[model samples]
Target: MSSRVLLVGIVRTPRQRWTKAEELEELAELTKTAGGEVVERIIQTRSQPDPATMIGKGKAIEIRELCRRYEIQLVVFEDLLSPTQLRNLEDIIGVRVIDRAAVILDIFALHARTAEAKAQVELAQLEYFKTRLTGLGIEMSRLGGGIGTRGPGETKLEVDRRRIDQRITTLRRELERIEQERQVQRKRRSRLFQIALAGYTNVGKSTLFNRLTAGATVVSDRLFATVDASTRVFKIDKKITALLTDTVGFIRNLPLQLVASFRSTLAEIRDADLILHIADISDPKVEGQIEVVNDTLATIGAGDNPQILVFNKCDKVFDDSLFTRLVARYPSAVFISARTGAGLDILQVRIKEFMEKQMVVKSFTIPAERTELAALVYAGGRIIGERILNGKRQIRIRGFAAELMRIRKEVRKRLL
Candidate 1:
């Protein structure tokens, strides 16, 4: 049976002009994604969360009564609660209380597919659980058969903290090794122009990635469908080949532990030649989502990379006037619907133009016998024109100037 859930939202700071009601709606959506049916919502505004309980003590009791009245089985907080506050709140409310971080982790646990993704999620969960391990004995005991408890030593819930710490260290080393392997693969693909799709979760990044490359990456309306980075080589034109990567979606107030744990997975974005910042234009919080993505990029030191703004899900917006206003505000932005293939061709054309502007032109002639040299040029860049004359093959190439220089050197070595 689906768990009956109550959502409690707390804003430590007063709601300013920029605060939107959409954040609370997002929290509700998160609860639903975790297989919880939200029966009640409680919002509290305070200078800071109560020291003893995340919400004020009276508010906690009120929520407890609501839970009892509505038969709520779980209470989800919209903010990350301190370990002390979590335990206190659970004791007062007489029910399991989970914070936003835990909810996000639960969704990740449910959606993780690959070994690397599973490992990364587990590592982040362990780190989060370690912080909240105190007074969680009862909760852990009850969690023997749930989505969050699918880890090693299921029987040892109230075990020594030292063991959990040791496991975290071990996982770190293993992840480091995995990261090194990824670095090697990254270096191998360094010759190709890399474009990474990054934006708020469920903003149609995976959809666009799939459309562009004919990939079957899982695309959903839910948060964080593509957690681990997925890269595919796609031809922009007959002459231009580039690597497109879809990465984990960003969210507001994402756990610091998660960001730290997924550093290796996110390194691809840092190394990318261009970033496609996709936003769900239909979402009411599209501007806030953009800010969150930009903040995450800045945290990862990829803020300086060239970026193209893509407003996706345009088909969902019916008002032409609103669309025109958005376009006027973001003149460089392109609107498209990956699901319906709307404005995709325009997006592709923009990409091609941007790429062309970054390319340099060069000419090379090789003997017909040196077919290998011609092949390298063809694979590495756009052959503007080519011809065979007098037992020699003449070709004109247009691409990244640095790439052409490297190809030229490799071809010369082959001739020698």
Candidate 2:
């Protein structure tokens, strides 16, 4: 059975750019995605958050009554609650009380399938609980069976700090090995143009990735449907085979625990030759979300990488005027619907054009007797034009600087 959940938030400033209502709605959506049934949303307006109960004592008492009346099994805060607040709320309301980070962590735990992804989620959960393990000994009794406890079971969580530290150390070493493996593989593909899809969560990044790579990655409307990095190959032009990676999506105010845990996974974005910043143009907060993605990229050390703004889901947009303004603002931006393949041709063309800028165009000729040398030249790059004259094969190719250099060295004796 789904847990009946109540959402609590504090509206610090009514004149804020975004309203408390919007935050609460997003919180509700997160709750639904986390498999909780939100029964009601309660907002407490205050100059500042209450140190103990978060929503203040009076509101806490009121929520206690509401919980009983509605038979609410869980209460989630839109903002993070300190250990004291979480314990106090659970004691007074006589139900499970978790903060937004916990809910997000729980969702990650739910979706994690691979060993590395599971380990990452577990590490994040432990890191979050390491500090909060105090004062909640009794309150966390219910934690033995619930969403937040998915990665680290009750037995592991109940252990002393020493055990958790040991486990964290183990996970870190494992992730290091995984990262090293990734680096070695990346070296093997150093010749390919690497592209990564980065954007706010549920912005159709996975959909676009699937469309481009002919992959079968699961696509859903829920936030964080893709929590692991998925990579595949796609052709930009006929001969330019590029590697495309779909990373876990970014979100507004993403929990620090997740960022720290998913560092290795996010390295795909950092290492990309180019980033495709996919945005849901139909969303009202699309611009804000785009900013969030940019901030996330900077945080992950991908700030300096080349990026192309891809406004996805344009088929869902009603206001073409907004799109025109967007196009005007970002002259190189591409609008496409990954679902219907609309504007995909344009996106591919734009990608090809962008990639071509980095390539070195060179002309080379190989002697007809050097059949092996001709094959090497063709393998090194896409041949734009080729002709045979004066008993020699002349070829014009566009390719990576390193590949061209290697080809030049291999065919140095066959040069014409």
Candidate 3:
């Protein structure tokens, strides 16, 4: 059964970044994503939030009466609430009250699939649970199916703080082990150039990955549909091969624990040779979403990587003039519809150009019987052609400088 949810947004004077209406709209979407139906949205304008109840005590009382009349089972706040505020609001409101952070964590838990993703989500949930140990009443913990009160919270209600802390430590150790294994693999793969896709939620990075590799990715219209990074080796024009990775989407705001736990997963983007910075051009908040991704990249120490601005979902864009203006703003950006495969040719050309710019042209010759050298050349570079000279195979190639240097050393060893 879908939960009947009442969403509350307390408007502070001169909202700094996002408007009240946008906040409420996003709140409604979040509630819906958590399998809840928003029955009402209430905006209370105030100089400041009440210390006890987020909205004033008098307003809380009135809202509680309305909830009872409407049979609303859940109330979600647009802002993060202090422990005291959460406890006091629930006591008077007579329903489950959850802040925005909890709702995001619950959605992440719901979508978690792989072991790494589950472990990360568990660690985040435990941290969130630790803070609410004292303030949220124990009785309310048993009440199920409400925002922030459901999923991992119910099973962990009885565990003491120390046990939860122990679990957190254990999870972190397990993740560290996983990260070590991944690091080893990355070291092995460093010879190959890597390109990573970083973007806001619901952008077409995964879709583009699927199209490029002929691999299936679970695509959806929901936010954060994929928590685990998806990576595949794809060839540009069937010669230049590089690792293409799809990373977890960036959001407007994330709790500190969530950010810390997910840092390991984003290491691919950090180590990438180039980043495809994708944005949903059709969304009204396209520019703001781009800024969010850039800020996240900077925070994670990946701000210096070269980027290709990819404006996806071009088919959905109705304003041609706006598109043209954006093109002028981002001269190198490629506007494409991954669904329709439109503008993909131009994107491929751009990728090839980036790849070529990173390569150093060279010429070498290998004996016809030296099949190993031929294979290495194919794996590590774009071959110009082969020639027959004095019963030997002459190869001309262009590849990354480091890879060419490595191959050159191997050839020297064989000659000696």
lDDT of 3 by residue, 1-416 (tens): 88898888877765533577787787788778888999988888888878888798898898899899899988888888888888888888987788888888878777777888888887887788677755566644443445565544224322466677889889899999999988998887888889999999888888988877788988888987888888898878767888899888887776667888887888999999999999999988898889989999998889999999999999998998988889898888999999999998888899999989999987777888888877877666878877878978888888898888888888878867
In model 3, which runs have C-alpha deviations exceeding 4 angstroms? 14-18, 143-145, 150-159, 362-371, 384-396, 409-416
lDDT of 2 by residue, 19-124 (tens): 7668788778878887889999887778888889888888888999999999998888888889888778777887778888888888887788777788888889
Candidate 3: 10-residue stretch with minimal lDDT? 150-159
TM-score, one value per model: 0.91, 0.91, 0.90
- What C-alpha RMSD separates each model from the true structure? 3.0, 3.0, 2.9
Best by TM-score: 2
Per-candidate local distance difference test? 0.82, 0.84, 0.83
Question: Between 1 and 2, whose TM-score is larger?
Answer: 2
| lDDT for model 3 | 0.83
- Where does candidate 2 clash, by residue pair? none
